[model samples]
Target: MKKRLSAAISSVGLILGTSLFSPAGAQEIDLYVDTVTKQVYTEPGKNRVKMGTFQQVQKGANRQDKKSSDRQAQKKTDQPAQKDSVQQARKDSSQQAQNEPGPAFVHEPLPERPKEEHWYDRMHIRGYTQFRNSTTVSGDKDAVVYWPDRSVGEDTSFLIRRARLILYGDITDNLYLYFQPDFASTPSGSTTGNFGQLRDAYADISFDDKKEFRVRLGQSKIPFSFENMQSSQNRLALDRADGINTCCRDERDIGAFFYWVPAEIRERFRELVANNLKGSGDYGVFAFGVYNGQGANRVELNNDMHMVARVTYPYQFSNGQIFEAGVEALHGRFVTSNGPVNGITPVMVAPAKGFVDERVAVHAVLYPQPFGLQAEWNWGRGPQLNGVQRLITESPLTGGYVQATYKYDSGPWGILFPFVKWQYYEGGQKFERNAPKNLVNDWELGVEWQVTKAIELTAVYHMMNRTDVLNAPYERFRADAVRFQVQWNY
Candidate 1:
């Protein structure tokens, strides 16, 4: 009986432990045992006696809770370091992304840049204006003299010598364009003044990227004289020497010209003009061209085209001084118009066709690096009025000038250029009405002050002896004058 009781109690403990002790939240339980019936009960009732409280000890659950707490504490302790490690990993990833190309799946497209402006938008509009005044300080004021700037003659008041507007641009890698118009032109025989006239209309087509080889086309200055090639705005003297100026009036004609220069030399030419050195810009180291024999603004009178060629070079010495020398020649026929006899009625004095108009010239220049010298001479045959026969004939002509100049930099005040020139010319002024014969011996002393980049002032004193181009009776006279000019650039 004792053995059976012990076995039954062991069986009950095993069953209860298996069912209750392993519950999720189970701990202890209270039970009442019926002593009369020998049965187990959870509550007290009839014939039930208090057995004892039983504790369901869950060893695995206690162990699991302790382990969970320990794990939580460990997590709290390591959280900062783990966070820093994660941040480091992200930083490295970002750095690597920058150094290498993005993955194909990333599908990131770079931003596009804006398009450049058009060539026309890049064109430049620039120009300069000159206002001049002249008075006969001495000599015969009534004498007739041909001054390139007509405003320099006696009885002339303040006038606009040149009012120009220049438009220029590089249209492409191999093409350039330049156009200029003057608003101060006076029409022949027209009383109205300030007529607008085209000065330069040309295009430079380059055969290479460097523009070392190029062709210029349209109405442009003829590569005849160095002084003629130099822009009037940049010339130190008020007027060009009659010797060279008489060859091509206005120094321009409609032509197609080919020019050649080394690329390095071309850059030096640009620097010369950019540095305010009195450079003729770049006609070329060598040039050849053909043009209508008629002068600028004149209608071509014949089928023949005039041929011209020039060769020039600028040499730089070890001391940084630049000197240039050139020779040029042109062959062509020139026709002249008749003027009124004694300022009354016009008549045909020139031949029905034209006269042999040709010339050869040589020039030298020592650029004004504090001190400078320039000279040019030309010999040609053109239609000239015979004073004795009272008829026009092709006559031999020769003329030239020598000039010296000094450049003084005045610091903030400005720059000063003092110059003196002497000229003599015996030629036919073909462009004049009668193609008058002229005898010229002149002296000019001038000083130019560059007040600023945009403004300049010049004063010149002149002593002149020349034939009167307007007087049909072949009058020769002498005159002295003082001229002043103010120029503005933009």
Candidate 2:
């Protein structure tokens, strides 16, 4: 009985040892636990190398898993919050679009640029008008007086002496043009027709870089005399000197002229012109031209062309005073009339032909600051009615005018100038009908007062002696007149 019992115990021991040592039973187990929840879990497919006790390894794994799960939960919570923010932004943008009104047009920025100017934009326009009243104070009403040209008329009357408009501008940097017309003119001796007349239509071509040299083309003032070149608006005397006037009647002709001034004196010349102080602009220190010799408004009757030249020099004092001297010469052929010659008299013989005409003149001027002096003298040979020959013949001629003036500037009252002029002329006026001989000695006293920049008043008293006018040969006459004039500029 004892042996059997021992055998049973041995058998039991063997069976338990075999099961524990088998290959499946030898595989290691890795256990993991959640530390916070205190739960156990098995990690499959992992080899267990004993680093510490099972509880320590399991506790480390459970702590790492718990941190990872916490991180994931936080990420999940943040995603929904970010999505809500995006949806809210979309909603706000939609609300703003609905609140604003739609624009009518899209805004576009304009390119900045300069305005272009047309050619006419550079044009300058100006004009003047004159009203005059004259009366004969010493001569009979029907008697021919010393007054010549348009100044000769009925004794006591008011007349429009001049109404003129001027247009001028530059077409390019080097080209300039000027135009002027007169509306009020006296009736021609040949016809009662009095109409608007063109005075100047010309262009200036500059050659030098500084424009010190130029050529003037078309109808322009002949460069024969300083006074003739001086604009009517600037003249101190009511009329131009007879000496110069006789050479080139009306002073303008269709011509080509060369003008030149030294660059140094050009500014001074411009200042004189701008001041309207009895000086032509830098027309030149030297000038020359060729023109139709028959005078302004008359067609050329002969093929011969008139040639004119002038040389002038100006000196300025430190006290703003100017003195100028000039010499002039003109040569031309003159035809008295285009009418059919009757062949009865010398007058008819001369009118049927052309004659040599020549003139030389010298002039000096002292621009009136407070005191001034101006004088011109001329001598020439021209066609004249010789009373002795009872026919037209070439004869010696001489003429000139001397003037002195005193100017006072009263500030706001404007300028006042008192002047005296003496003129003597002995010549023949071929332009006048019948080639009338003219013998004139005249004295004029005048006062000019400038009320404003645009207005001026002048009064003149004249004493004269004249001969051989209006078909009367050797008939001497003395006449005097008082003239009043008002001028306005615009």
Candidate 3:
């Protein structure tokens, strides 16, 4: 009877304890889980727990309490495992979604990248070179006087005038980059080979297909005269501007420019040459902020020009010709060598003292049939240099040019183009018994032959008369030159 009673009491305690210990507290799904751990577990009363370490609870804390403690410890231990399991589930869900798709896609858009980072997205490359040999039968002068060469005068000569390499590309949909390097002839042929001096480095971004709301930054072409912007890689003539004012170097500045292009054409442009622009390829308005104006990769003692602005229009004629026209203004601040009463100081000069360096200009280029013509005119008033006693020119200065070129498209291995250029300019200090009115006029005859994609040959004859001088003798300085050149491009 006593044995039976003890057995019955033991059975009751066992039942009660078993009922209280619930595996539901583990609260897990989909596993034959043992509920063991990959991490340490702190019992209901224990301190901080660390992963992959062992922990134990004291004995006789109710012994029953110990069992409960172990279960509670399991819940804590599973916290991290729960996180890992959740991640795995998500990954699986995503894969399933991809497999069941009617064209899988992401809801979020991709991030945009800078132009420099996406250089090859939209890229274009081009390059050219010219060489020539000429037999001279003329007067006893050399190349343009500014750059005198005694190597060959009125006699025959062989030369390489242009050896060039160019790289141009676009980034994203609207940004662009362009570079040109002249490796052929140096400023003095071999005497000065300025390799890798960037010919052009600028980032361009535009709003749309019409290219409105555009910005260009870095070292780029100065929006100035026609000759200054024309590319040397392909000048229709052997000699540009009769080599009078055609160094065309210093035609760039390190700066940023803002521009707006128009979508429509105008009547005046159509009438002028079927189609014309402001020397700008499209109709637009432009404003520039130049940091250093003495071209790119150069250092100057004086400050650079502050602003250059222009309004322009283009015309597309029914005859398949194009023309452009524009008006522009400029304002610059600088310190002149003429000033600084003391050596340690810098005295600023007033650029607008005598006249408005403000200028009015008009340009037109015509492409009709076998002939092409381009012309520009500029008239502006400028500050006269202050003499020890002020003596300035009475009126603003005027300068311009009218140029024509005739080209015959490629036939066999060569293309022939003959061109003529004429210019007239006068702007100088009148104060000096030495300073006088200035003008330059030139005439050239030349032809080019392409020997290969990378090689070109050229031959030419030129004559020039320069009238800009400080008490220049005999009204003008004249020259006659004969040249031939050969070049390689890479």
Candidate 4:
């Protein structure tokens, strides 16, 4: 019995050892055990004990691996159904999300507001005053020689030609305003002089961001003549040409004007003024407007408005010299007032309806980049007194002036401009009380010294032969006069 049991145990040990050491692909092994001795064997026939075939345990593997394998196999069989279930769950979740409403409120940033500008910062103040004195050094002391600056002519009395205050500002990006008042104006026939008068009250509205197109409204300078449009403060000549000056009494009238200029050209115009080249400001490359026919500060007598138009351009050379040329024309009906002439004798009665007032002028300017020349001429028919008939009738008139000047920069000593001008006009003095027929032949030589930015001095000698339109028997008066003016700018 011991030999048999030993043999069975040895056989079982051999089978177990083979199963543990064999490769994973090896076949299962069969075994038997003796019931009484509990001895195992690989063959069933020897001990008459039977054991079923079993899984081969690989080397270093645990007994629980079979249970794990059974679970893995069951998971593989159920994979398709599980995958479908997961897909259906995702689809259901997406549909539920779409059916539900979103959150009640969402947070967002607010837009910022623009800062407002202060009134004081939106406006600017600037002005100039001219103190002047003039005497007829070699002519009749009582002879009245009408001057462009009517304040100083024959009297040696010291006077103020202009005491102006200007307020200008850009109210917004597209709107600009300009206002000026002259405190030194002397009203005709008034005993007291130096009364304040409106000079300019206008607004410029830009139509584009570049400000190339604009419209000016209210009382402003008429675009009738180049010299007429030039500001007296910037002019080198003490007086404007009588030919052009006669066309517009105060060089201004209530009107609306349109101006168009390229942005680049506008800068050049500003540079000319900033450099003291006597620029006319930005009058535009082309300008047209309608204004009251009765001149500045005067009531319109007729329903018809004065139509005026002008075209001008400044050309710059490679050497930085600028030249300009332009033409302007105006047509209107003017009613001469039968009122007392400067508180003097009333002349012939004017037409009840009005007289045809029309003119066409041409002007040229060479900005003094050292040396300059300016000239203007006009021809037209206007109301003038027929001395023999003593009636105000339309008469042909023509006149103009030519001026030459030189600009000198003296560094710290400031600057100087010496000019010579000769002017002739055979026309009607429409602004005068009688609308008298007048002839003006004048020669002037002057030097303007800009001692400083705030101070300026001008001295001019004039030889004038002009008709005395004030007195009843209008006679031509000749005089040699000298005038001096000092200007203060701020």
Candidate 5:
């Protein structure tokens, strides 16, 4: 009896041990992360492994024997069903857990919200002031001389040509003004005078405090040419863009322009400058209603209201580059019939001569990382000369320029952008003869130092490289001009 009792106890112990160590007691599972597709795994020491619904657990229940062999056989027959049942139980538990929240702190509290930038307290008082020395190879040669003096070197000399002062303040939240005055006109040509001209007197209004959509009015840049309209204060080179905007000595115009930008689009922008999207120039109607048709340099006004407009489209590529393009057009009225005499003698002939002024332009560029290229062309009717009448009529003059820029965003000296530009221009009736049938070219090379967020400085050297016969007389083929400027923003 004692032996039978001991045998029973041993059998029970064996059965319990088998169940405790069975595959049912423990199972292995695999998991993977969604995006990285990396194997989802848990540290051996982690409290609990975070596993998703994906699971495969095959387990079996222990076989308990009865007194009869048939009963033992029956239990063996139930092994498959029992294994299925165990796995099903695990699946059910996983589903229930999915429906319910996980145990405490499944995800950590995001690093405390970064302190929001205080925009209201931010009143950015930023602008630039620069002193420039200019030496014209020959702006005054014809002014004081009856006949050209080959030995006088009268056409080549340097003087303090421009003294610029710019002030822009965030007066209150919605209202702002940019008043930049240029003290220039140390005339070296025929006359010498010191005069001050208003470069920018614009009031900026925005829909929101952040200035997403803005409106600017007053004497600002005309949205005509990139080189023409780029703020002289921010230019990386010297002299001008070599286009009509600079070559014509017409930089700013008194007008108004509205800016429209999409929120997503703004994010993609490189944001080199806070107001990079703000076009100092844009296309709109009644562009001539408020100001003279000629650029800022011309004091005369035309008869008809001038109109200008621009449209730009941007595209994004998978290779992580963004490109954009735009088109612009303007029309105005100017005295086409002129000369020392009069008659319809437009040299660079256009459709409407001696009456209305019309200009059309288009520009496009593809901006890749660290590199950008821009090009533009402008054709219009302006003062013309009569080959027939020895008079100035509405003549057509065209100006265009191309430029390339390369930048290294990360350097010991902060972001550095060096660029090269070339331009072809013809405007005055006499100058049109010099224009090549196809094109002419002016060149420039320079580097910009973005030194700091509040301060920017640049120096550039400029030259005109064209055949003496094809390039404009003012567009003398040989020249070397250096320009330097700095800006401070509070």
Candidate 6:
């Protein structure tokens, strides 16, 4: 009987434990044991039904409650450890950021860079102007002595000799460009009336590290005469001698020229150029070129091209004086007007063959150190019309000029230079209409006072004896003049 009782109690405890610990549901039944009937019962939806008998239903319920309490305490202990681990992870992240090299927070992106400018945008500009006045001092009213191109017709006149604007700059590391225009150019069919004309438009292509060797293309000054190559704004004399002027009218042409100078002497070349002596940039000891023989502003008359070359060396003494020597040559064709085949018959003929013109020249200069000297001579052959018959015939001619000058650098008065020149020329000017024969003896004395860096004043006296082969009635004439000029440069 005791065994039966114990079995029933144990069964009831198991059923109760399963009902309380198992997952609960909405329609679950509540199992119960009736001690009076010693039987189990179930209460489902408020109806109690007998299930089984049990002696310790209360003890089983108490044991279940103890287990639930222990489970809740364990959950509470594990939650704090989970929270500490999460906090430690956050702290580790902060420490890592502090140990880093750069900023803790990323910076806003940098603004995009501005666009770069083109090479042409960096161009440089410079220019100068000469205002001149001249009067015949001891000559006929019609006697145009110096600068026949700018003669004083009424014994005195004011003239804008030269007004120029220069534009130059580097196009690239190995390329450079230069351009100049003259507003004072004479009116001609090739140009607009005195508005302006292109003087120099050229590009320099450098091959060496220091640009000691270069090739120049376009219309630029030919490398023939030192005086011819020298900038008119820098010349000490009022005008270039007829001897050298006849070599190259305007001293510029459409051509390609090669220039070379040693790197060691480049600084010296720059110095001379800066001082406005006869230095041709860094155009070294050797220069040569080929051009249209008709000269600047003139179209080529014949198919033949003119060839020019020069060889020069500039030496500097310990005393800071400079001496330069050079030789130059040019070979070209000169076109002339055609004449009647039968002189008295009044029958016309084809134009005479183009004159084969050629010349060779030598020049030397001693840069002024308070006192200096310069000299140049040239000889050439070209078609010359006879004084009376006016027929083209080849003739040999020679001419040159000698100049002496003294420079004084006065403190407030600026640089003062007094100079004297003697020039003589007997030549055939092929570029002229009839190829006139020119016999000229001229003397000039001048003083240049630089009032400031941008201003200059000059006064000059001249004496001359000239023979014009083209003018029939007045082939020979003697003339003299006094001239004054003011120049502004920037």
User: Top lDDT: which candidate number?
Assistant: 1
| Whole-model lDDT, model 6 | 0.72
Weakest lDDT window of 10 consecutive positions for candidate 1: 99-108
Q: Cα lDDT for residue 416, model 1? A: 97
Runs in model 6 deviating more than 4 A are: 1-115, 145-151, 188-193, 276-280, 338-353, 468-474
lDDT of 2 by residue, 404-473 (tens): 9987988999989889999888888767666767877888899989899899999998776776455443
Sequence-dependent TM-score of model 3: 0.56
Clashes of each: 0, 0, 17, 0, 14, 9
State the local distance difference test value for candidate 3.
0.49
lDDT of each: 0.81, 0.72, 0.49, 0.80, 0.50, 0.72
Model 1, runs deviating above 4 Å = 1-116, 340-352
RMSD (CA, Å), candidate 4 to true, equals 22.0
* Residue 79 Cα positional deviation in candidate 3, in Å, after optimal superposition: 68
lDDT of 4 by residue, 231-283 (tens): 88999888788888888878999999999999999998899889899999999
The ten-residue window of minimal lDDT in model 2 covers 48-57
Better of 1 and 5 by TM-score: 1
TM-score of each model, paired residue for residue: 0.76, 0.76, 0.56, 0.74, 0.54, 0.73
Q: What would the per-residue lDDT of candidate 6 be over residues 1-490, giving only the tens digit for each residue? A: 4544554465455444444433222123344433333333333211224553322233366675766666466655644653453344334433432343343233457999998989878689999999888877666657453335364446456788889999999888789999999998875324233568888999999996788889999999989877887788888887888888887768889999998888768788788868745354665589988988777878777887888889999898888889999999999777755343224211111134377778999999898866889999999887676656446677788999999988788899798889999999997766665566788898899999989979999998887788654343326677777788899999
Q: Cα miss at 291, model 3 (Å)?
A: 5.3
lDDT of 5 by residue, 271-326 (tens): 42343321223332212223455556555544444566666655678886656666
If candidate 2 were superposed on the true structure by all CA atoms, what would the RMSD be?
Answer: 23.2
Clashes of 5: 14
Q: Which residue ranges in model 3 land beyond 4 Å of their true spot? A: 1-124, 130-144, 147-160, 184-191, 239-249, 262-291, 300-304, 334-358, 381-396, 410-414, 428-438, 448-457, 467-476, 485-490
Assess the local accuracy of residue 483 in candidate 3 as a C-alpha lDDT between 0 and 100. 66
